[model samples]
Target: MSSSLLCLVFLFFTIVAEATYSPGGFHHLSSLRQNKKASKSKPKLPFETRYFPQNLDHFSFTPESYKVFYQKYLINNRFWRKGGPIFVYTGNEGDIDWFATNTGFMSDIAPKFRALLVFIEHRFYGESMPFGKKLHKSPETLGYLSSQQALADYAILIRSLKQNLSSEASPVVVFGGSYGGMLAAWFRLKYPHITIGALASSAPILHFDNIVPLTSFYDAISQDFKDASVNCFNVIKRSWEELDAISTKKNGLPELSKKFRTCKGLHSQYSTRDWLMGAFVYTAMVNYATAANFMAPLPGYPVEEMCKIVDKFPRGSSNLDCAFAAASLYYNYSGSEKCFKIEQQTDDHGLDGWQWQACTEMVMPMSCSNQSMFPPYDNDYEAFKENCMSRYGVKPRPHWITTEFGGMKIETVLKRFGSNIIFSNGMQDPWSRGGVLKNISSSIVALVTKKGAHHADLRAATKDDPEWLKEQRRQEIAIIEKWISDYYRDLKED
Candidate 1:
């Protein structure tokens, strides 16, 4: 392989390794459900990797439109009968295959509806690099990796796919979780002529702008532990102060290294500590009723399990030791590493690309605070903007997402041009507060679950699923069926 291809492969594995728990460092959705007792293994859906145009801009405003093709992987299970709807998953940050494999909900329902299943890779992520690995790191080319361009890519891809397959009459229903979920809903809103409806799960559409509180993300994580056990919350609360105290002392860095079993001595970078703490955040997000492999090999009720450890910590042990032990449940689950290395978290070629994305368009305003479980760490806009500009040479657009896509004004837009989009959120998810949680209209609905974590409803039906999830999935299936029927009925009228 060429150096660029080698870089791509290295990045791919790095993301997958982190994805054993969390990918992209931003909030993600965990799907794929089976019965509590029935662990139905997901069969690999073979997909051919294809490429599409890079410079989609037709206005010819740029110096010269670079003609290039980006990769997109898809799986067509041949389930579609004549005129059956198409099920398209709007891929998020990471490889499309990961989303395709974990999201069994689409596959399960595809066979039921005889729908065609396709997973489109997000540009700049996975193997869909527009400029290859060389230009990928260049700030000039990174400007094209915005969500607007991505949605356009989906629109163009779907249009071409329909024409090529001669499935013009077939209605398309988009499905996605997290960032992709936001894309699904936005795609249906912007390109309704292309897709009939969208199922957006755990999409923080309103997380941007001043629409939702900035503290909502960490607050939700804190609540997860509090719900699990107040003792766990207390231990975590004290652990931050303990870690801070230890870090501030003359010998604090070395002490932390000893406590956390760091391979190298603790550095001055706060990211090391932040990384150790982030494991808790991941645990809370994927705290499913059953063990999940979305981010890591976490057991069912991971937050609860971690709490059990904190609640049983030895009375004389230092809070730092307790925190290390708790964090070890996540970072050192396999107990394979000789020492904890913070470099493993950030030092990756693929993660470097994701960090660029986070620095630019995907400026998720997440932070920690004394109000939450962890210590108060402000992520003020000025600092955030400065960091993005310093790192990516592009200023962070705090309100651009809402300005371009209609944040709080989404309700009015949906009421006017949007319908058949199910905005689902789990109450436990911090990202849920930023999503549409109530009915915007009859067809535009929100499905909120008390036990659902992140995009739990997007997972395949599981025997271990709570009653509420079972009902939620049933309602989603029914809503999707109605969307297809309504689309066909309207097509006949046309």
Candidate 2:
């Protein structure tokens, strides 16, 4: 009876083991053991800490310019660990001079965490010129140049990084400011797996579609012009509005870029650059779109100009300092003058309109030289307004002004995305209108700075004599990092 029982028990155990195994017996047992080990072991996180040269390399995605651009990223240090998430940076429309001065930056955070910093010429402006090629031809062509495409471009690059490392590298985190902020938000939304996190500084995530908030801009800009004083900015605002109301009729008067483009050196003859710059900044704070983008989220402007300007800008600036890069790029040469020093320009920012009477009256046009900024556009206005209103989550309008061509709206296309999104606005930014924050809904997390400006004026800062600016930048960054980390925590994969 004992022998029978023992034999039966051994047979039963053998049968149970075989039934659970993958059919090849001991070889199957070997696999089972591996599975048990895998279950117990922590799988490797996705990235590697690779050091890049302090000088970030830039090349045209197309064959045109054969031109070279030095997309700068003052790489800090490696991430703290051997296998932390990769950090890759891509920003919106800025020229190399921005890197030369490191204007509007505070990326020391990247190295502190062992992130890789890289900057690319956002396709058009800087040395990233598609000079010889008609790469950015029409709006439809420009529509192709989207954040969706940018995600593809970035993913391709990250895959190359993964292949080079020959390891399961962690995901990347994209960082940007202004339009770059828009890109960062769209990139994560478009490809969450590729980007584990993102930090958007002074980015107008909510204003990409419309920017009528400038009715309030005159006050803010004027107040700042006063150096936190009372009368300083007020005097300038009083003079500016009188002229702006008039200019909006002729050549969309205050839009300095188009006016500057047409008038060139005589910018001072009509109005000072201060009014133009103020209008440019204020109009854009609420509506950050390419000039032509008034019509659609995707634009009829060449893709390069697609990260549109919310308001039409005159091509040049009165402040010689802010005018050079764009002037040089478009006219293909800088005029005899250059940008005045920052301190000098800051002073100039507050001067009374009475001081420059003749110039303001003369250079300005009573006509819309740049057709896109005014009525009777080459493209239909009503349709663009409808699409734009829809894209930014505004109540759709049957008609407004626009000939914009992009068909995809954020609500229609981007709303499909769940969490994994972030946005930013500057408290001091004239454009951080209420509409932008209201439109995006519950899925996106937005960051606001205490004293930030139109863009990441804080991200671009190092040490501030006033001290207030620097602290604000830090708070902005912390908020960004927290949102990103939270996003990563929730979707860290199974």
Best by TM-score: 1
Against the hidden true structure, what lDDT does model 2 obtain? 0.34
Per-residue lDDT tens digits for candidate 2, residues 1-494, read: 01001000000011111111000001111111212211223233222323221111133345432333222223323444434556555634333233213323434565554554445444333434332225443332333333343445456556665565553454467766544555565576666777766655444433222333312322343333333323323232343444445445655533544434433332332333332332322222322222211111121111122112211235342323232222222212123323321111111111111111101110100111121121111222343334333333333221111112111354554455545455556555543442134334555555555544544442333342235545545655565566556655766764
What TM-score, computed on C-alpha atoms, does each candidate reach?
A: 0.88, 0.48
Number of clashing pairs, model 1? 13
Could you tell me how far off, in angstroms, the CA of residue 477 lies in candidate 2 after the best superposition?
5.4
How high is the CA lDDT of each candidate model? 0.68, 0.34
Specify the poorest-scoring 10-residue window by lDDT in model 2: 3-12
- Candidate 2 stretches with Cα past 4 Å from truth are 1-82, 96-106, 130-144, 208-219, 222-227, 238-417, 420-422, 434-444, 457-494
lDDT of 1 by residue, 1-494 (tens): 01111011110111111221122223221111111011233346655557766564533566555556665768675687757788999988766776776688987787889998889988887778777767777787776776787888888888888888887898989999887898898898888889889999988888666577766776888898899898778778877667667667988777767776666786653534555455776677677787766655677878888888887877766776666677777765555656666533332113345555555655556444677887655545675566556566887666676677787777787688678899998888767777898899999999998867878877766777778888888999999999888778888999
Worst window of 10 by summed lDDT in candidate 1? 2-11
Model 1 alpha-carbon drift over 4 Å, by segment: 1-44, 53-63, 269-272, 346-351
